[model samples]
Target: MRRASSLIAYAIACCLGWPAQAQDYPAHPIRIIVPTQAGGVSDILSRTFANKVQNATGATVVVENRTGANGVLAADYVAKSTPDGYTVYLGFQGTQSVLPHVEPKLPYDPTRDFAPVVLLATGPAVLVVHPSMPARSVKELVELAKAKPGAYSYASAGFGTTHHLAAEMFKLAAGVDLTGVTYRGAAPANQDVIAGHVPIEFDNLGLAVNNIRSGAVRPLAITAKDRSPLLPDVPTMAEAGYPSVIAQSWFAFFVPAKTPRPAIDWLNRQANEVFSDPAMRDQFLRQGLVLPLGSPEFLGQHVAEETQRWGEVIRKAKITLPN
Candidate 1:
């Protein structure tokens, strides 16, 4: 009898245009899971947004690092967590788009397991070479790699990452035979390039910006349609005669599928409010990220498009990772 009474009360509340949970949403602290290690661009960006959201909503937002399996672990954890608004995942290009193509047995489906929240930011990968290397431009690098024919090598975050795929695309377009050296993450891969251990690498602009400015590594070209404002003098891959070699990494937010509509709407509004701030815009821009805020539907469409695009690249390149 009591359970029936409670259901009747909830129905009455809904009929009156009031939902109790939505009205008092986010009543407790929220937790965000970052799938990568601390100090990388993704980690920094996730923490920055988390801080902004906490300040805006006056709710505790805790960021937890659950790094492993190229972000599969964290993504799976969030996908299986409660559908309440409290648990969120920072979804990136690898987990959302790339892995589905390269890894045949992903534990969670990108499209089916999560609800899109918002598209946060996007940035092109920068092709940088050690100062000790002879190449000064993208064309020169291609020529050098052709001349050596597998003598020169490039580094990547790991197999199936954007960094790896970007290098593969460059190889196919430029018709070069450069070997790829894999690392656990971008930081270590970039570190080898900066230390002159690796001759070349394709890294996110945000991670390579400081080193580029310091002359620790020389940037050949950015993998975007246009040159980034942060590196205005650098030409794009298209300008370097490889028009098909364009690639960029993007970040978004997601919650488990079947989450309440009102909770999702509230989270979207909060994200838009935080990203629309002038200060936040400038901060992201300085780090070589372009903030392109859009609706959840827009993010869903972007994810689908990117998955198809990268899947083709992976198939053509014959890219695969170990199980």
Candidate 2:
């Protein structure tokens, strides 16, 4: 009886300690899933995090781009993955906000299907214009658009993308109608704007920063509440007298659903640590990423807010996409 009781105690201890043992967390190479193709902002940020995490923890971090369906494919993949913290997702505003509004049959719920890790960045869009637009300020641009409603056209990366919705909001707030031309990705949209084929676009800061600096495009306003440090003289839409017009993109990390809180917390702490490092902060800023971050709770709140906010925009704009 004594021997049997001792054996039972040993078994119980192992069972209880199973998760703790696995708390070495990423025992093998981990995957950082970027829902878009390589070279996009989300992909770039995910790679940065992957490299930093690999250096900090000695765990091999691989960035896997699973692009399609405006991120539904990759998001669904991550949603159904094991809750063992081995698979991490890099999510952006499109997946969290626009996709849900545009497509009602999403396979996974953004808030419920994943464990929110930490916000990666809140990169604002810049109001980029062709070189010959003759609008150097937000007021001037509004005047120009007002003078010729629907004459000035803008190109966006896609239908229902944050860039498109932001442009829609800007049109409503500025009381001007700019024809929207959709493209497959930022590269083509930005290309048309730079070549003066389209007169205006509100492009993601990271995507347009180099071109804006190189005179490929001109920036009039940044779509944040405050002007971007990179564009010091540019006014925010709200600051430029358009309070209801704000378009910003937020990127976040997530683990599969039901992941242990400890694992999620640890990843969040690691991300916060990375964000607080001045070197990382400066490097990200140079990459056109702004740190607007906090705990997983903050990401949860952000998801809720943006989901509702973009929903309203889509409804009012009566926006629909083409196949």
Number of the top lDDT candidate: 1
After superposition, candidate 1 runs with Cα above 4 Å error: 1-20
Clashes of each: 0, 0
Model 1: lDDT to the true structure: 0.88
Worst 10 residues of 1 by lDDT: 13-22
Model 2 lDDT tens row, 117-219: 8888988888888989898888998899889888899999888776788999988777888999999878899888888999899898877888988999988
TM-score for all predictions?
0.89, 0.89
Give per-residue CA lDDT, model 1, range 204-282, as digits (tens).
8988899999999999999988899999999999999999888888889899998887888888888888888999889
Lowest lDDT 10-residue stretch of candidate 2: 18-27
